[model samples]
Each structure stands twice: as C-alpha cells, then as structure tokens.
Target: MRPHTLALLLLLLATPAATRLASAACAGEKFPAGRAYAACEDLPKLGASLHWTYDAAKSSLSVAFVAAPAAAGGWVAWGLNPTGEGMAGAQALVALAGSGSGSAAPTVRTYNITGYVPLGNVSTPLDFPATDLAADAAAGGRIRVYGTLQLREGMRAVNQVWQVGASSTAGAPDKHAFQPDNLGAKSKLVLAGKSPAAASPSPAPAPHASGGGAASSKSPNAAAAAAGVAAPVALVLALVGFLATV
Candidate 1:
C-alpha cells in the first residue's frame, strides 16, 4: 500500500474515535444541558449572580453571559455536571451568532458552548456533542446553555473529562490528567439581550420584612388596618364603597 494511502486509511478509522472522545469521558451516560465550556474567565464573570434567568412568561430559560477571552487557568471545555445525577444527556448550545447571510463569511469565534453538566463542577473539562444537538430536545430534555470556550491539549493519560450522566467527574488517565493548556488569542463575548424570566414583571420588593415594622402593620383594608396602615380607614372605605357599587 502506498504511504499516503495508508495514512488516509488511518485517519478515516480514527474519525469516529475522535468524535466520541469529543462527547466526554464515558460513564455509561451523557453530558449535561444549559452549561457551556470556554477557555476564558471574563465570560463567566460578566453575568454575576443568577446567571440563569427563567422566563416564566415563555416557560423557557434565558442565560445571559459575556464571552470573555481566555486567561491563565481559563475554562477549557464544558459538559454535564457529573454530579447531576439521573439526567445527563440534557444539553444546550449558546453561541454569539452574528449577523450573516450564510456560513460563507469568517464568522465570529465567540465563547459559546455545546452542553452542560447537571451538577456544578467547573474545575475540569467535559465533552462537546457537536452532533447530538437535537437528541436532547427530541427526548423532551432541557439545557441551561451558557457561552463558553475550550481548546484541546491532545493529552489522554489522566484527568480525562469523564461525564457519566449523573456520576463521578472522573475519566481515563488520558483525560483525568489534563496537561497545561493555553489559548493565545483575543476572544470577546458581547452582552446580548436577555429575556425576562417572567412577563418582565415589576420588581417585587425584596422579602425584607423587618420584625413587623410599619409596612407590616398595613392591612388589605382600613377595616383591618393596625395603625401602621397608611391613609387608614378613609382609603379602605372608598375602595369598599366602589366595590359595593360595582
């Protein structure tokens, strides 16, 4: 066999192996949803607390994050929280899809993501099911997709990102032991518009009742007002009178 032909055959045989490895460390399970992998810290820091905002109106989850470039000890890949027991195959994908007519232009290399881990462990890396995007949705699954980035170091001896649905965050020696990796380019994440968790309802007052203060003594009606009620009985009487007439 010609040398080039042998090389081609070897590459072809390794394609599936390569693809499977991309999923994650096998734990007889799958990755998580609503999570992402990136090689940058700035991205995760952009959206402070409550990175996930639930849109009760649409009955959908909206994630807001800024795609930041990779820094030292940046995030490598993302997967289901190995700790997220029972539901691993759940996944999601959040990318900075820019305005483009087609896949012809040099697209923006944003700190987007592939899937998530049910349990939260952001120290190690996971898989990116580039092919299984729809499998989850078809199975009535959901994901909390976050924007992320990742780059491979081509090492597989220890600390392999083993994502076994809802199991331990371990992997083959090749994965369990991740070599020092780096991303040597500027990657940016823009703050895209986020959807409201509810009907964008007015900000409800924080649950800040202070030992039954003046605000607490107020009543639904002055008839039951406990002195702390502002504008007291007259206000209540008018409301009750209006209701009676109606």
Candidate 2:
C-alpha cells in the first residue's frame, strides 16, 4: 500500500477503543439541544453539550457550548441580528481543547460546521482562523455542524445541536432561533432551542423567586455549577485539533 493509504488504515483501527465506547454512551441520549444525542462517532468532538435558550431579551437566542468545563472555561453562542433577508440565523464555531484549564485555539485542518443530521443539506463545510461564530437565537438553536481537518492523517467529525421550538406544523422540526445581538457578554454567547420550560422575557435567573426577591430555597452554588458545565465542553474543542493554545 502507498504511504498515505497505509496511514489512513492505521488511523481508523488505531482510534482509542474508548472513542467508540464513548460514542455508544452518547447514543440515543437526548442532547442538551433536545434530540437524541448521537453516538460518539456521530457526536462533535466537544462532547454532548449545546444547551441553548433565548436571551434575557426574549428577542435573541443564547447558546452555551458546553454544560461544564473540564475545569474552568466559558461558552459561545451564535445569533442573528439582521432582521433582513428573512434570513435570521447565525453560527458559533468554538475551539475546544484540553483538560483542567479547558481551552485552546488550534492550527488543525479547519472545516466548517455542518450541524446535525437532515439539516446537513444546509450545512456547509468551512475553514477558519481559529475564531468562534455567533448568529441569532434561531440560528443557534437546532442545527448540524461538522468540520474537516487537513492534518497528517486528515480528520472529519460532526457536532450537532437540534432545534427546539413551539411549531405545531405536523412533521415540522422545531428550529432553534435567535433575534440577534439583543444582548451578550464576553466568555458567553446566545441561542435558544425548543424549550417550553424556558421562561419568556428571558429565562428567570435560577436564584429568583416568584414574588420578586432572591429565594433562600434556591442555591446559588447550584446555578454556578450548572454554568460551569458549559465551560469545559467549550474548552474541549480547543484541545482536539487546535494548532495553538488560547
């Protein structure tokens, strides 16, 4: 066999058996995005994250890339702002990497994210300079993502977060949508999937009370913990193919 062909064969067989095992663990599990989380092989390298909801403004979606970081990290979101084009969606390409510190920007074979399954038709394979993307609320919701890397062995994987919405149309997929930069902050992003449980006017802060004051019943530590889950996964992507550390 030729040199490149031989290398490819080794890569397929040499992948840590854990990868397949992890894929199996994720199989049929509901992604934070709502749909059945795909198998590990089918999942994005960043793990089964993609928890999303509309922003505090209710006009935009807020997507957190991961649930918690391996240690300390933040999430990203993609949302739409241009009310134009009837085109109201955006993309957030996050760099996931490492353990502990949990983030990195690599110089790997960069490819565009093609989101989830059926939507693959709409997803386009792309390349970039290790930057993240953010569209509108709807844009961040349900979608397919994948990338191709031109490394010594070449690489490809799909990372998806399915959309969630309140559409009653039969057989209609509830899409995750966002209005646009209605609001945002550093170390965070926005995109809301279909979450009926999600509060309108914005998801109520976890510590909030129905009457209008911080509730002693709710634990602030718990909310902070949930927030951290997002950080690790955000950083995971930076590990796999990042060319450099962030």
Question: Residue 151's C-alpha lDDT in candidate 2?
Answer: 18
Residue lDDT tens for model 2, 1-246: 456755654554444332332334323323322221111222232333343322223232223332221222222222221212121222324322222432223111122333332222122433322222322211222223222111112112112332222321222222323423211111111122222111112123232122121212213433443354445544444443342432
Give the top-scoring candidate (TM-score): 2
Kindly list the per-residue Cα lDDT of model 1 for residues 1-246, writing each as its tens digit.
556755754554345333332322111122243232211121212221122222222222222223221221112222222223211332323221212342321111111123332223222223421221211110112121232222123311111111101112222111112222221111222111321111111121122222110111111221222232233333444645555665
- Report how far off residue 208 is in candidate 1 (Å): 31
C-alpha lDDT of all candidate models, in order: 0.24, 0.27
The estimated TM-scores of all candidates read 0.20, 0.21
Worst 10 residues of 1 by lDDT: 155-164
Clashes in candidate 1: how many? Answer: 38
Off by over 4 Å in 2: 1-47, 56-58, 67-90, 98-246
The TM-score of predicted model 1 comes to 0.20
Point out where model 1 deviates above 4 Å. 1-50, 67-90, 94-246
